[model samples]
Target: MATYLITGATGGIGEAICRRLAPLHSLILVARDQAKLDALALTLGGSHHAWATDMGQDGAIDAFTARMESEQVTLDGVVLMPPQPHADDNPMPTPDVWRHLFQVSFIGPLALLKGAVARMNPDPAEGRRAKIVIISGISSAQVLSHYATANVIRTAWVGEAKTLAFALGSRGIHVNTLSLGGTLSPWYRDKLEERAQKNGISFQAQLTIETDNVPLRKYGEPAEVAIVVEGLLSQFSDHMTGLNILHDGGFTRAY
Candidate 1:
């Protein structure tokens, strides 16, 4: 069984991934809330380790790596999904806003990857010895006026992932980004609910309006995301690397 470190282990997508991978692999769950992480580990019913780590905090990444050293947990893969600040809250951007956003969106994840490499690398195997998937939003591709900071910061990750793929491929490590869109996460559902309230319409009506452009006319399920992540981490995608997999419902227009 493989050992994987999943940052942002408390989110809906993160939870689904843990459930999907729990039966087959050993998991290192990381998040900010010790209580929540411990509860999740309990529910997963395995020897998974939970770490209450805030990756955005200074030195947190380094500390986490040190802890892993003590445990001697050699990771076979990593899933990066550190919680980002809600840019919608600060519609009017400031220098501090941009700096904080960049640090969280870009720098923190990069540090995570750097730490993950030491745990995953130097395998004698001919094929991939490790896989890393960055869980970014479709804002990396499409524009979201509400998430002003995200549109720019997340975009940088795509380029970074590509470069790392080429640099790390020879070491039997694969890196990719999974960009999601219109998923029924609690955050998205709340946004739809708010719109429905403002428009004096039913939630379904608002949802229909929001998803009109989607060919599937539906939001991808959390379980579906788990399945896709499973594919990315498994040997099924051994030949794939350095690519961004768009999980949007066929809405992105750019070629």
Candidate 2:
């Protein structure tokens, strides 16, 4: 089985991806909480390994590579699910907000991708061409009411992925971004509930209003996200590269 590294392992979408991939492949679960990563590794019931490191801080990617080198582990693919912006990441963002967002969302994650791919491709022993799937939000491609930090940082990642795809295509590496819309994760649920309270409406009403613009009129589930990740890392890579595939249930209106 191929070994894939999944960053942000304990988050809603990350955990779902792990569960979906575990049956067919080995995993390297990455997150800041060693304890949580260990617990998740156990639940998946496999020969999975866990690596805990804060991808937001400086030198974090270097340290992760050091550990991987010591273990002589090479990756066949990656599923990068960087942290979403916090509540303070508003439109007129502060300096601190921008710094934190850039460090965690953009620099750190892309650094890890570079490091991981360095150990992959150009080696015949590594087998199939490597795949890199970056998980992001539709806000980067389309305007949202808020999410200023997400808009800027995720858009940068989209561009970076395309650039990387161009540089790595000849090396048998595929780089792409999965732009997501609303999903029924805990975080989104809380946001919907909060909006519902402010508008004096039921949670269902809030959810419907939120998804009204989506052609499917629905929010995606974490499991569905996992399925898409699996495809991109497998069949879809044969001829596709550098594309930011949208998983928004028709929520995006822009071209």
Candidate 3:
């Protein structure tokens, strides 16, 4: 079985991905919450291991590399699923928050990939080639004023993945970004609740507006997004790289 390294494995979409792949592969879960990771590990059974560390912290990547070495872990794939809809109540967004988002969304994933590729054996006799899938938001391409940091940083990360794809293609590592539209996950519900409370609107009313706003006439489920992610991580996509595959339900009208 292939071994997978997944960051942000406790988050909404991240959790979905874990549930989908846990039974099929050996999983190394990475997240900031030890308690949550431990709980997930227990629930997923013994084939999964949890590593609690803040991927955004300075030198975090190096520390993770050391841990992998100690564990003798070799990864066949990596999934980057950082926080989405990063928002703050600050009247003006601080530089720290901006930098934090960029670090988590872009730098952290690249660091993990750097470590994974360096450790993975290139011989096809070892197993299938390595793959890296980045879970990004539709806002990365769309203009969402409230989610400025995600918009800017995710876009940059997508570009970085494409560049890395070309450079790493010869090394048997495929890199791609999975851009998602609005999906009905815990994170999405939390944002809806926040919007409702702030606007003095009912949660149902807010949800109605959001669903109606989408061309698909409904919000996507986390499982739906997971399906797309699974496809990207599968062997069928071995020949593909440097692509931004969007799962927006046709919400993005721009060509």
Best by TM-score: 1
Sorted on lDDT, best first, the list reads: 2, 1, 3
* Candidate 2, poorest ten consecutive residues by summed lDDT: 119-128
Clash count for each candidate, listed in order shown = 0, 0, 0
lDDT of 2 by residue, 1-255 (tens): 888999988988999999999998999999999999999999999899998988887677799988888888878899998787644446887798778788888888878877788777444245468899999898769767667768888889899999999999888888889999888877878888999999999999988898888899899999999999999999566689999999999978777
Q: Total backbone clashes of model 2?
A: 0
User: TM-score for all predictions?
Assistant: 0.94, 0.93, 0.89
Tens-digit per-residue lDDT, 40-65, candidate 3: 98888858989887767658778988
Clashing pairs in 3: none
Model 1: residues with Cα > 4 Å off, grouped in runs: 89-92, 122-128
TM-score, prediction 1: 0.94
> After aligning candidate 1 to the native by TM-score, how far in Å is the CA of 117 from where it should be?
1.1
Q: Whole-model Cα lDDT per candidate?
A: 0.85, 0.86, 0.80
Worst 10 residues of 1 by lDDT: 82-91
